[model samples]
Target: MQDVISKLVKVQELEMRATKVSASDAEVIKALRKGIPDPILAHYDRLRIRGKKGVAIIRNQVCTSCHMGVAIGTIVTLKQGKDIQLCGSCGRYLHLPPEPASETAVAMLPAKPKRKKRAAVRVPDAS
Candidate 1:
């Protein structure tokens, strides 16, 4: 379900970019819309009419569009990608980005040693 949503989001973004370049691109947008499920597409159109994004990324268990935290159970379900999940607060589709390979590799690197602070020296005063 999430995969379908991802593809639809990509198509929508492409259509938006295409329309900005040439009016002839309207045909391409129409073709892209045909591939999406009618219900999902209709929902997306409704959201657009309401001036909100149809899809939103989930980061740190929070919905990026609404800036509201999602419950842990819902986050787990979204990560599993078993079903379509919508943000309770803003009603936008939720997607979790895959963690980068470099991040895990960097985490395994050795930590830098801490340096000790030098003690302050005091000058003796002449009597």
Candidate 2:
């Protein structure tokens, strides 16, 4: 699962780079494509043909490509890395980026104490 997604991402990157420069990376793209399953590669090619990204990142449980909210089940599946998940809205492959190590460490730390509110002071009224 993860392996396939990683390869797909790499292929996408290479293709993007290839488009920018005159030099071609056909060999590398060909090699990466060989690792992916035919059906998956076909779908990816189809999306590319339409001038869209084949792989999309899932951020804050939303599809970055289509800017649509993704289902919780799909997020869970992506996190589990048990299988490939696609965005229902755009039909693009969904990949949940791994949490940063600092974030995980921060989450484990105890929360800071909240500040207390000050009581209002009373003032004498002039007659």
Identify the leading candidate in terms of TM-score.
2
Worst 10 residues of 1 by lDDT: 111-120
Among residues 3 or more apart in sequence or in different chains, the pairs in candidate 2 whose N, CA or C atoms overlap within 3 Å are: none
lDDT of 2 at 36: 97
**Judged by lDDT against the true structure, how good is candidate 1?**
0.66
Clashing residue pair totals per candidate (backbone < 3 A): 0, 0
Q: Candidate 1 residues 1-127, lDDT tens each?
A: 7676776667557655543645556666676677778888888888867766887887765779878766566666655678777777777777777756443332234443322332235767877
User: Model 1 residue 57 lDDT?
Assistant: 81
Stretches off by above 4 angstroms in model 2 are 20-24, 101-127
For candidate 2, write residues 32-99 as lDDT tens digits.
89999999999999999999999999877678997877766666666678999877778899877888
- TM-scores of all predicted structures: 0.64, 0.74
Residue 83's lDDT in candidate 1: 75
